[model samples]
Target chain A: MNSNTRPVADPRPAFVENPEQADQQQALGRRIITDGIRTVFLVGCGGSLAAYGPSVYTLDNRVPQLVVQAMNSDEFNYRKPAGLGPTSIVLVGSHTGTTAETVRAIDTAKAAGAESVVSLTSDPESPLATHADLAFTDRPTKWAWDPKEIAMARITQGILDAAGLAASGFDEALAALPADIPNVFADLDPALHRIAEDLATKPVTYALGSGPMEGMARAFAMFYMQEMLWRHAAAYNAGEFLHGPFEMTESQAPYLVLCGEDATRPMTDRALGFLNRYSEHVHVIDSREFRLAGVPDGVRAEIAPIVMSAVTTRLAQHLEAVLDHDLSTRRYMFSVEY
Target chain B: MNSNTRPVADPRPAFVENPEQADQQQALGRRIITDGIRTVFLVGCGGSLAAYGPSVYTLDNRVPQLVVQAMNSDEFNYRKPAGLGPTSIVLVGSHTGTTAETVRAIDTAKAAGAESVVSLTSDPESPLATHADLAFTDRPTKWAWDPKEIAMARITQGILDAAGLAASGFDEALAALPADIPNVFADLDPALHRIAEDLATKPVTYALGSGPMEGMARAFAMFYMQEMLWRHAAAYNAGEFLHGPFEMTESQAPYLVLCGEDATRPMTDRALGFLNRYSEHVHVIDSREFRLAGVPDGVRAEIAPIVMSAVTTRLAQHLEAVLDHDLSTRRYMFSVEY
Candidate 1:
């Protein structure tokens, strides 16, 4: 069967079956500290790249001792950073583990003499996982905050914990995700269905978010809408939306605003205020609205981006159902070679 | 006269007349070294924030000793990094020097006990300049790579030189800009007029670039096309464009691809190849086409983005003329408050 013709599956989170995966992630972190790694470079493509948002945001805000950077995999390989040497660790992600640039990033890291190369993907047998010094494979998932992001977040938590910068409740939050994520879907599904219906025929959709949630916005706008549905869409940082893209507000284009319970919430709030006044087709998915039972308050904001990503994924699913479009279909991706 | 009602002048560069401005920038860098500043946070809004791209890219690639970051002013203030304390310097930019969040970022920087607060703005008397510990003022210009970006680039060079990581030809290239930029306009005008006319009636235009040139892509798509022309436009990092947004290629949308003579040129080259195969309305502005007289080959790529920015600005000017839409016209910004 042609992979491009595969039917769209319902979006859902998939977890690693091996409980020792957590220990493995911790071991990776211990290796970084033990090896005297001073920098961590996160490189990936598309939604895989977006999955690093929460972890990057957390590291940027909380872990000040180490240098952290995120880049699209191809750019990472092309503009090789001067800092990515023996004192650096490269964490690369790709859902299929066959993304050409991501697989090459492992080679790039090795070429740069990085202390270690880690990969997160669903296909354990693929090139990316086979090439990396360490690989974490989870069950395949088509949604955000699933196998890849969950493992990536766990790996980041492991790194932070190893560095003595671990925040309380982070581990607890991770443990609770299995039970908590289903509740998030149940709570969000109805609203998402309504949103999908409203947005189905819109000329163009604009997704806006700030800070960590901005990644989810990009995932929804670029990956889901443009790639999956072949719909016109674009994502903008909320603060930046005010700077220029706000001109489209009065155009009455549909909008999806992801509001995470982080410090950058005010930016989305400000944009929302203007959006509500100027456009009638505005849909907001606020992370604060959902309660993840076992996740405590301190870590909620840290993990809100992941939850919001999950919501956007479910919304994309609803749009797929309503529009009768297969998410796997593509015009040029693998069908016609460039 | 209401600033909003003012006529749109032909876009051009306005520079600072003070030779001592360069000395002041070098002195600022010297202070950073003397005060043991370890982190340099570049904060701004809209085009102001985009101006820091090349400097960020350069610092990340050439000088790995310091922690360098760029963020929207609001996000910078909201998610204040734990690292932003006594050993940090905050460089903020705003064209009018009165952007609310940029002014607030100065307070945020001061409250965090940063070593110094630097403001780059056209208005010396504005609150941002008035409150910042050090302010650099330049002549007002409504375009990319003009007063703000030039000053920011100079400041970056100063920091690099102070840290003994100075690359040869950077200063020589800076010195050549005044004479070189007008030639860029002359060189690009005919092609740009055609591009502007071709793009004027398009429902949406997409801009793509890689590495240093990506900043110019964003400035053109967001600041120029969206804000100034009130048109729908979006920018994609050329490498990332393949990840998802490339799905729009066959839609026959007009695309503006900026190619610079940099390591990441191949990323854009790959995208341009795919674009050429898939789309008919692809317009490319390659920096290698322009001979920046005094800028040696070593530093040409570093300054290529600035030149590409000038070309895009010229393109926007032609767009404004062809569309019969005043670039200064705005529906909501400063008109009806949110």
Candidate 2:
């Protein structure tokens, strides 16, 4: 566990205090089903949308009644979904709630026939939250566990419940998820520091995961490593990595494999074995190693990705510490308009 | 454009001579509609699935009646879709038709109720083709504009046609498409060599596009660069690049932007502008530059991705020449099993 720097804030704490917000969001989700909403567009940009991948996959597989689609903010705003309109629910996800495309997508969604809008963000004051029909806000953190993700899961649960496909007591299980910010570095896991130290100056790095954890692995490599740390890195699905990306692997290039306990563990384990053979710097972050305090075994598989994010959040920060790079450094994000 | 090497064969030449095969596939697609197939699961692994991206996007937005789902072979094999069954069509895509997950996915799809199966591959004797109810075979090509991709497009066209959801005269336009193998080097485009020279030694390269071109862009980066050239690279959607990935776009890093002439052109153009200001190595490949011979304007819009693939296939080969890297060079692909 990391202890030298301030721990990243948990986005879920504010949700515990404002339990009504979840209820309101859940009611909105259920209403969408009851009201005959034809489509639910889970809309956002970059990290916001990538983070919702697991939820989308779950929602698509679990609730087959509703046509669930994830749209990129700019494309959603540029041409927009033809199916969007009064009977469509556009759920806009933006951590800052200030992403220009997502902010515009809310209005665009409505203009395109979005009758119900659910804004998931950290800032209630942001344009998206201010204008949405239901605003699910949590305490803001630039790079941390997305509290709104949990809220989105709850909302999706309500949708499932209304559709008569709820995963027996899934809502209660979701509500019971820990609200406490994790001490990811409290134990100072050697793997975390080892990856950061070894990859401090590596020319390029790769991360891999499968199942719902693919999103978390992507966030770690694309968001935290490339976006925050400005490191040269890439992320691939564990299965696809062997199919094509293995050629790029060598002794110098490191592979950070996120071995989450899920249906795809064997595939990732195979990747790890291959990386271990070919690459000198193979960092493995297995969810089984970390004690996810207060997280029940029932909801653990579904939420393992959320746990992976919290763990990698610390790893990204530790990487910054080793490289002497500030996470706040930016090149044209919020600083300049495209 | 490329004069020194043998021109890559167009995969559709056999289709012209074997017209009855297409009629058989079209009859199958029509039967899918007649039989009331409710869902279409377009399944494949990395490059195979990535290549069908444009067709899928077009089908998704255009053919709203059918639930069109694209699934990874491993994911589909592990947690087969609950919606799969006799009312569903599983279109298995693999260049070699030897992908293990895909082979299992076919049986899983059948077990889950896939009544009609369409196997798209180069080898008719392959496991997927041998087991599938309908196999659409094309002549094989490795690390080039996938021959299977053309076959997949025709099958999708037939599916769209059966549903009466196809664009106006789309089939006529498709039939008129030239069978002439694209001499991507006919014009001897310098940009291909420029991109290869610029990125020959770059530690990391980023590729981006939208719509069907997004898949082509992904294939070029993941399949061509990483898998074929043994180069380190990553690919992302054009619109998403601005939301977070811009942070990694330093002056030194090259950004290969595929600006296709589609609805998403403006979005890619916006990204190109941003990359121009930030990165020195910004390679833009726009489909409008290449005139796909004998293709009508109406079909060109939909078939632009096939054209894009043809154009970039040369770029991949050119990169090999500049880097002196053989396209067949592999660490584990066919040489060893994982």
Q: Which model scores highest in TM-score?
A: 1
| Residues B1-338, model 1: lDDT tens digits | 12232333455753544568777886786666656788999999998999888888887887666778899998899999867998899999999998999999999999999988999888789898899988888754434456776776777787788778877998788888878877877777889888988898688888999998888898898999999888888889998889888886764689999999889999999999999988899999999888689888888888888777777877877887777777788888888876
lDDT of each: 0.83, 0.74
What local lDDT score does residue A217 receive in model 2, on the 0 to 100 scale? 82
Q: Which lDDT value does model 2 have at B260?
A: 75
- After TM-score superposition, what is the CA distance of residue A225 in candidate 2 from its true location, in Å? 1.1
Candidate 2 local lDDT, B1-338, one digit each (tens): 22354433323222342466767766766676777877788888877887668767776666556667887888777666657777788889888888988988888887887777788887889998898888877654343355565666766777778888766655665555444334334553577777877887687789999877778888888989999988778898888778767887888888888877777788898888888988888988877766556666666678778767767777877777777667777878887767
> Which residue pairs collide in model 1, if any?
none
Give me candidate 1's TM-score against the actual structure: 0.94
Error of 2 at A31 (Å): 3.1
Residue B160 error for model 1, in Å?
2.7
Candidate 1: give its CA RMSD in angstroms: 3.8
**Real contacts recovered, all predictions:** 0.77, 0.61
